[model samples]
Target: MAINRLLVLFLLIINCNLYFSQEVVIKDDKVLLDGKQILKAEKISLAQYSFFSVKDDEEVLLYKYMDNETPSYVNDDFFILNFLTEKIKVESTDLGKVSNFMNSKKAMEKIIKWLLKERVINRNGELNPDRIVIFKEKYDENITARTLR
Candidate 1:
């Protein structure tokens, strides 16, 4: 039983290390690699997926795999749903804003606006308006919620 527990712990550490090694983080609406800016997120468009494509389930699965391998902007609950209905609307309330950045780019934009309203970032110009990737959320509690290094 002890050996099994140790094995599981080892596997967990190995999995975490894999993600820790290669990270793609969002900083000031720009994509960063190894703590350096790479792609300008806001300047980029959603119509043309410059990084990962989520056209089909297979592609989404690939994204999930890639997300597992790298530091993720997306959490386990991340999803993208497209539909039109009166009941389905962006939550305009400011009280609870967690998991707001999911489903669609439009939703992400709305979340960004909300974050801006909440003063999460000085301006949209200074933060990723769509996605923000960090290594681990719990590990970065004091983090300004903008630039994650």
Candidate 2:
């Protein structure tokens, strides 16, 4: 019985670690998730909008969105920057020409610069303390809600 309990406890620990262990690294204008390239820099154009999609066979782990505040009547340009396992959605008309912003590397760099300017992350792509605090609060709220459920 003790051995079984130990094994279960070990498994639970490993599961928890896997759940929270997401390492986001930006290198050479490419986003690497756990050291694997996930962004393909390809565009999917539709009648209404065109945006880049994540690489095939990869899970989305991080996401961000931005807008240039262009009027609704005009065609808008946007970017999708995926860091690790999620999506980064950015749409801005003032971001310059559509063709240039459509490139995933440019979009990712633009968003990363914005993140740095906003102090959300340090120059090395690590989350700053303020961002960490926000994350902790969200985690606490999530845990509380789960317990209530």
Candidate 3:
């Protein structure tokens, strides 16, 4: 029994190391995954739907921002969504006023920070696929109703 437990623990550690071995590197207008250019960043204007697209070889990461109220110019609650899957919507109300992130560098930096904080992307710059599955199974649809418009 003890030997089985040790083997399990060892396997767990190896798995963790594998996951953490991946690295995400951000350069000017480029997102590098494990030293390869996987995405190119570009700024755009799409009203409330999106601010930019981080285009990878096979997928486009639409970076969206939703303001929940009339343009008060202050205290307007917002949500940042759609980096990977639409199932996850991050409330940015407590994070302060989110304006149009038009600068590619700044926008990508902020997006990466949020992704890291939310664990949507692992430290090695890989998407946490489990987040999508978990969110789809348990995410609240109504939480985004106010911002959908």
lDDT of 2 by residue, 40-133 (tens): 3222332122212243534332433333254353443243333342222222333442233345445554544455445555533454555544
> How does each model score on TM-score?
0.25, 0.30, 0.48
| Tens-digit lDDT string for candidate 3 (24-114) | 5567656665676645655555333232234434333455554456665635644455544444544444433234355444555565555
lDDT of 1 by residue, 30-82 (tens): 44545654334432333212222112212110111112224555342222211
Which predicted model would earn the best TM-score?
3
Instruction: Kindly provide the TM-score of model 3 when superposed on the true structure, using C-alpha atoms.
Output: 0.48
RMSD of candidate 1 to the truth, in angstroms, is: 17.4
The lDDT of model 3 is 0.52
lDDT over C-alpha atoms for residue 131 of model 1? 26
Query: Using lDDT as the measure, what is the rank order of every candidate, best first?
Result: 3, 2, 1
For candidate 2, the TM-score is 0.30
**Each model's C-alpha lDDT?**
0.33, 0.42, 0.52
Which runs in model 3 stand beyond 4 Å of their true positions? 1-28, 32-38, 46-56, 83-87, 96-104, 123-125, 132-143, 146-149
Report the alpha-carbon TM-score of model 1 versus the true structure. Answer: 0.25
